[model samples]
Target: MVGLGTMGAGIAETLAHRGLAVVGVERDHESLRRARARLAHSLDRAQGHGRLDPPSREDLLARIGLGTDLAAVADCDLVIEAIDERMDAKAALFARLDALCPPGTVLVTNTSSLSVTELAAGTGRPARVLGMHWFNPAPVMGLVEVVRTVVTDPDALEAVVALAGAAGKTAVVAADRAGFIVNALLFGYLNNAVRMVESRFATREDVDAAMRLGCGHPMGPLALLDLIGLDAAQAILASMYEQTGDHRHAPAPLLGQLVAAGLLGRKAGRGFYPYTAPDSGEVVGTGTAVGTGTAVGTGTAAAVEVPPVRRVGVVGSGTMALGIAEVLARSGHEVIVRARRPDAADGVRARVRTSLDAAVAKGRLSEQDRDGALSRLRATTDLGDLGGCDLVLEAVVEDLAVKRELFTDLDKVARPGAVLATTTSSLPVIDCAMATSRPEDVVGMHWFNPAPAMRLVEIVPTVLTGETAIAGALGLARAAGRHPVRCADRAGFIVNALLFPYLNDAVRMVEANYATIDDIDTAMTVGCGHPLGPFALADVVGLDVTLAITRSLYEQFREPAYVPAPLLEHLVRAGFLGRKTGRGFREHRRR
Candidate 1:
C-alpha cells in the first residue's frame, strides 16, 4: 500500500485479514499512527462481534507492516497504491516504486479519475502498471474498477482480478475514463439535478422526492450532492469534462458558490440542503444560505412562484396520452385531448376509462375522483377546440417533422400566449421553436414513457422561449402531480442524455464479458443502490428509443462517445423493443 489514508488503510486491513502480508507505506509517521489505530480498533470490534477468533485476529494484525520506505514492497508480488488523486503525484510515486520493487510486482493505483496510460508511462513499466480503482471505505464497497491501459499485461490483469475476488470484492474492468462506470453514470445525473435547481423548475424537496419515490433511487440527487462535497463533485466533473467535453459534466454555478461558502457538503454542515447529522443526511438544520437566485431558508425558498395552468390541452390517442390526460384531470385541470380523427378520440376515451377504472380498483382513485376525472376529460379530433387552453402539450409521435408541423399549426391557431409544448424524447426543441411564429411559447415537456407512473417530467426550454412559457410548462407538469426538471433545449434533455450513454457503456462492458447480466445488475442494485440496472432499465425504456437518443447526442455533441453500441442497434434491428415488444434485454411474455 502506498498511503495510509481512509481508503488505503481499509484496503491494507482487508488484505491483511485475508492472510496476505501488507507493506503499508505512508509519506509521514502521523498517518501511519492513525491507520494503525484504525486497524486495531476495527479488529477489536470484529473480535467482540465474534467475527474474528483470537488466533486469526493476532495473525491478521501481525501481517500488516507500517513503513515509510517504498523499498519494503520489493518482496511482495502485488502492491496497490491508495493515495490522493493527483496525476503528477501518483506518477512520481509509481515511478519510484517501479525503480524499487521487483519487475514482477503488479503495481496499481487506486485512482478513480487519473489516466492509467500516463501513470504507466511515468513508471517506465507500462506492462505491470494498471488502475485498481476502489470505492470509498474499500473494505465495505463491493465493486472495484480494474482499469487496463493498452500496454497492461494480461497476466497482471488476471492476477489483480483474482486478488480482488480473494479480498471479497467484485471487480469490473473499466476503460481508462474519468469516472469509469458508477461515478460517471452517477455524477452526470447529479450535475443535471443541480442545473434543475439553478433554473427553479421545482423545489429541492420536490426534486428529491421525485427521484426517491418516482425512480426508486437510494438517495435523492440533492441530498447525495450534499453528501458528496461540492469540491469533490467539481473534481469529478472536471475530469469528466476533460474526457468527454460535454457541457453536462460542467458543474453548476451553485455548486461552486456553496463550496466557496465553506458549505462543502455534510463535512461542512451544508451543500444543497443543510445537514443536521453531517454525513447521515438527516435534516438537523432548517433553511439554506441566502443567494441571488433562490435564497432558501427554513427549507423553503422566499419566492413563492405562482404558476399559470388553469386549463391544459393534452394531445394524444395512446396509452401515454391517456395516462397524461388522467394525471392532468386528477390534478384538477380541465383536460382537452385531441386525436387525429373522431375514432382516435374514442380510443383515447376508452383507454382513459380503463386506466381510471383500474386506478379505482386499486383504491388509488375513488368513485367520486374517477367520475370527476372523467368529467374533466373531453376528447376531440380537432386542434381548434384547444384555442382557449392555457397550455397545449402534444404527446404524439417522437418524430421531428410531425412535432414541428403540430407546433406550427398551434402557433397560428391556439390562443395568444398559451404555452405550446411537445412531449418529444429526443427531437431538438429549437427545430420546433423555429417552426412556430411564437417561438417563445414553444417548450419540451418530456415525461418518462409512462406519464402517470413515472414521476419525472423534464421541462425543456430553448433560448427563444420566455420565462413564463418555461414556468407555465413546469407548473402544469407539477399540477399534474409530476416532478419537473428544467433543462436547456438539447438533444436528449437531462435524463435521457445522461442515461443512454451509461446504458451503452454497460453494453460495452457486457461485450467484453466483464461480468454476466445477473452479476452486473446485482452489483449495480446492491452496490450502488440504483432502483434498476442499466440493461434492465434499457429494456423498460425501449432499445429503439435508446438508440435514437444516443444517435442524437452523438450528432449534437459531435462526441463519438455517444454512439449507440452495435449490440443495442442489433437488438433494435431484431425488433426486440423491450417489454412493449415482449423481448429486449431479457425476454418477456406477451399478454
Candidate 2:
C-alpha cells in the first residue's frame, strides 16, 4: 500500500485482517506515525465491536509493517496506490513504484474515477497494472472493482480477483474508462441533484428526502455527495465530462462554487448542509444554507393557511388507489374510495384489507391499528358519496380524457371548495385543471407506488392553481406522514424529470453492448450503493412505463437525450412489460 490516507489505511487494515503480509508505505515519519495510529484506532473499534478479540487484533496488526520509504515495498508481490485522485500525482507515484518493485509485481490503483489504463501506461509494467478499486471503509464494504486495461495481463487481473475474494470482498470486473462503472453512473446523478437545486425545482432537503424515502436509497444524493467530499465529487464529475463530452455530466456551477469556497463537505463541516463539527454526521439546521426558506432562485414557497381535511375520497380501483386510500385511513382520516362499479369497489376494499393485513404481518402495523384503519375506510360506486368529502384525489388511469372526464364529474359532484388532486405521473396537470370549472382546486399529487411505504408526495400546481389548493395538498401529504416537494406542473415534475434520462442512458449503454446486464447491475449496486441498478429498476417500473415517461419528456423538450432507447421500445413491443408480465430486461416469475 502507498500513501496511507483513508483509502490506504483502510485497505491495509483489510489486507492484514485477511492474514496477508502487508507493507504500508508513506512519504515521511510524521505521516507514517499517523497512518499507524489510524490503523490501531480502527482495529481497536473492531475489537470493541466483538468482530476481533484482543489477541487476534494484535496478531493482525503484527502482519502489517508501516514505513516512510517506498523501498519497503520492494519484496511485495502487489503494491496498491491509494492516494489523492490526481492523474499526475498518481502517475508519478506509479512510475517510482514500477522502478522499486520486483519484476511482474501487480501494480494496482484504488482510483474511483481516473482511467486505470492511463495510469498503467505511465509505468514499465503496463500488463501487470490493474485497478483494485475498493469502496470506502474497506473493512466493511464488501465490493472491489477489478478494472482491466486493454494491455493488462489476464493473469494479473485474475490474481487481483482471487486476492479480493481472499480479503472477503465481492469483485466485479470492468474495462478501464473514465468513472469506470460506478462513478460514471453515480456522479452524474449527484450532479443532477445539484442542478435540481440550482433550478429551484425543489429544495435540497426535499430532493434528498425524495430519494431516501421515495426511492429507498440509504442516503439522499446530496448527503452522499457530502460524505464523499465535494472536492472529490467535483474531480470525478469533471473527469467524466471530459471523457464523455456529455453536457449532463458537467459539474453543476453551484457544486464548483461550493468546492472553490472551501465548503468541501463533512471534512470542512459544510457543503450542501452545515455541520456542527468537521467530519461530523450531524447536520446543523432545518434547511440548507444555500437557499432561504425552502427555495433558491424564483423565491420560496408562499405561506398559505390551509383548511383542515376530515373526509378524503380516492377515485380508482388500481393498486395506487388502494394504497392511497390505505395511507389516508392510516393517517386517521375517513377515506371513501369510488370505483366505476360495485364489484370494482369491492375489489378495491379487498386489496386495501390485504395490504393492511400484510402490514400487520410485517410488524409495520398493530392488529388494532389495522382494524381501526379498515374501519375508517369505505368503498362505494357512487360519485355522490364524495359530495361530503373535503378532498378528492383522482388516482385513475393515465389517459387525459379519462382524467378530464373524472375531474369534470368531480367538480360537479364534490362539495364546494373541496381540493381536487390527480395522481398523474406524466400527463400535464394543467390540462386536467382546465377541464374542471374550479381550476384553482385541481392540483397534481403524485404518490410513488406502495404509497404506504414511500414517503414522497410531489405537490404539483398548475399556472392557475390557487394558494389554498397548494397548501391543502402539502398539508394532506404531511398529515399522511409524507415528505412533500412543491414543483411546477411540467413533464416528469421533480424526480422523474431528472431520473428517467439517466435510466434511458443506461439503456443506451446496454444497447451499445458496453457491458452485460449482470455486470452493469453489480457495478451500480456495489460501487455506488444504489438500492437497485437502472435495469432492475426499469424492470420493476415496467419498461412500458419507462418508455411512456421518456416519450413524454422527449415530446415536451424535444431533446435527443430524452428519446427512448431502441432496446427499451423493442422489449415493450414484445409484451415484456416487466414484473407484471414476468419478463422485461431480465426474467422474473409472475407473482
Candidate 3:
C-alpha cells in the first residue's frame, strides 16, 4: 500500500487483516508515524466492536510493515497506489513504480474518478495496470470497483478479483472512464443537491429529510457530501465533468465557494453546515433539524395556524388511496374513502382489513385497536359523503386533467375551510389548485408509495395557496406519523427531482456500454448504501413510470442531462414495463 493516508492506511489494514503481508509506504517519517497511529486506532475500534479479538488484532498488525521508503515494494508481487487524486502526481508515481518494480509485477491505482486508461498509459506495462477503487473505512465496506483498461491483461484482472474476494469484498468490473460506476452515478446527484441548496428551493434539513424518509436512503446527499470533504467532491466532479462534458457533472458553484473559504467539511468544522468540532459528526445549532412543516431557510412565509382535523376523506381507489385511508384510520382519525364504483370501495375495505389483520397477527396492532380503527373507517361510492370531512386528500392518478377535474368537484362538495390536498408526485400543485375557485385551500401532500410504511410527506404549497392550508396539510401529515417537508410546487418536488436524474444517468451508463447492469447495481448497493441500485429500483418502480417522471423533469428544467435515456424509452416502447411485465432492465420472476 502506497501513500499511507486515511484511505491508504485503511486499505493496508484490510489487506493485513486478510493475512496478506503489506508494506505500507508514506512520503516522510512524520507521515508514516501518523499512518501507524491511524491503523492502530482503527484496529482498536474493530476490537471494541467485537469484530476482532485481541489476539487476532495483534496478528493483523504483525502482518503490516510501515516505512517511508518506496523502493521496499520492488520485491512485492503486487503494488497498490492509494495516492492523492492529482493526475500528474499519480502518473509520476506510476512511472516511478514501473521503473523500480519487476516487469511482471502488477500495478494498481485506487482512483475513484480519474481515468484508469490514462493512468495505465503512463506505465511501461499498460496491461499490468488496473484500478481497485475501495470505499472509505475499507475493512468495513463490502465493495471494490475493479476498473479495467482496454489494454489491461486478463490475468492481472483475475488476480485482483481473487485478492478482493479473499479479503471478503465483492468486486465489480467497469470500463476505464471518469467516475467509473459509483462516482459517475453518485456525484451527479450530490452536485444537484448542492444546486438545490444554492437555489434555495429547499432548506438543508428538508432536502436531507426528503431523501432519508421518502427514499429510504441511509444518509442525505448534503450530509454525505460533508462526510466526503467538499474539496474532494469538487475534484471528483471536476474530473467527471471534464471527461464526460456533461453539464450535470459540473461542480456546483457553491461547492467551489465553500472550498475557497476553507470550509472543506467535517475536517474544517464546517461545510454545508457547522459541525460541533473538526472531524466530529455532531452538528451545531438547532436550525438543521428537520421541522414538522414550518418554513425555515425556505423563502416562503411561516405557516399559518394549523386547522383542527378530525374527519378525513381520501379519494381514489388505487393502492395509494387505500394505504392513505388505512394510515389515517390507524392514527385515530375518522376516515371516509370515496371510490368511483361500489366494487372499488369494497376492494378498498377488503385491502385495509387484510392489512390490519396482518398488523394484528404481527403484534403491531392490538385486536381492539384494529377493531376501533376499522370502525372509524367508512368506504363509499358517493362523493357527497365527503362534504363533512375536515380535510380531503386526493390520491388520484398523475394526470393533471384528472386531478384538476377532481379538485373542481372536491371544491364544491367539501365543507367550507376544508384543506384540499393532492398526492401527485410529479405534476405542478398549482395546476390542480387552479382548477377550483378555492385555490387558496389546495396544497400538495405527496406521500410515498405504501403510505402505511413510509413516513415522508412532501407538503408543497403554490403561489396562491393559503398559509392555513399549508398548516392543515402539515398537521395532518404529522398526526398520521409522517415527517412533513415543505417545498414549492414544482415538477418532481424534492425527492423525485433529485432521484430520477441519477437513475437516468445510470441508464446512460448501460446505454454507453461502460458497465453491465449487475456491476453498476453492485457498485451502488455495496459502495454507497443505497437501498436499491438505479436499474433494480427502476424495475421495481416500473420503466413507464420512471420514464414519465424523467420527462416531467426535463420539461420543467430543460436540462440536457434530464432527457430520458433512449434505452429506457425503447424498453418501455417494447412493453417491458418492469416487474409488472416480468421484464425491464432485467428479468423478474412473476409472483
The candidate that achieves the highest TM-score relative to the unseen native structure? 3
Cα lDDT tens digits for candidate 3, 491-565:
888999999999999999998888999999988998988889889999999999999999999999999989999
lDDT of each: 0.79, 0.86, 0.89
Ranking by lDDT: 3, 2, 1
Q: Estimate each model's TM-score.
A: 0.76, 0.92, 0.95
User: What lDDT score goes with residue 57 in model 3?
Assistant: 88
* Model 3, residue pairs in steric clash: none
For candidate 3, give the lDDT of residue 457: 93
lDDT of 1 at 20: 86
Off by over 4 Å in 2: 291-293, 296-303, 357-376, 557-559
Instruction: Please give the lDDT score at residue 317 for candidate 2.
Output: 82
Worst 10 residues of 2 by lDDT: 292-301
TM-score-based ranking:
3, 2, 1
Model 2, residue 578: distance off in Å is: 2.0
* Candidate 2 lDDT over residue span 411-445, tens digit each: 89998899999999999999999998999888899
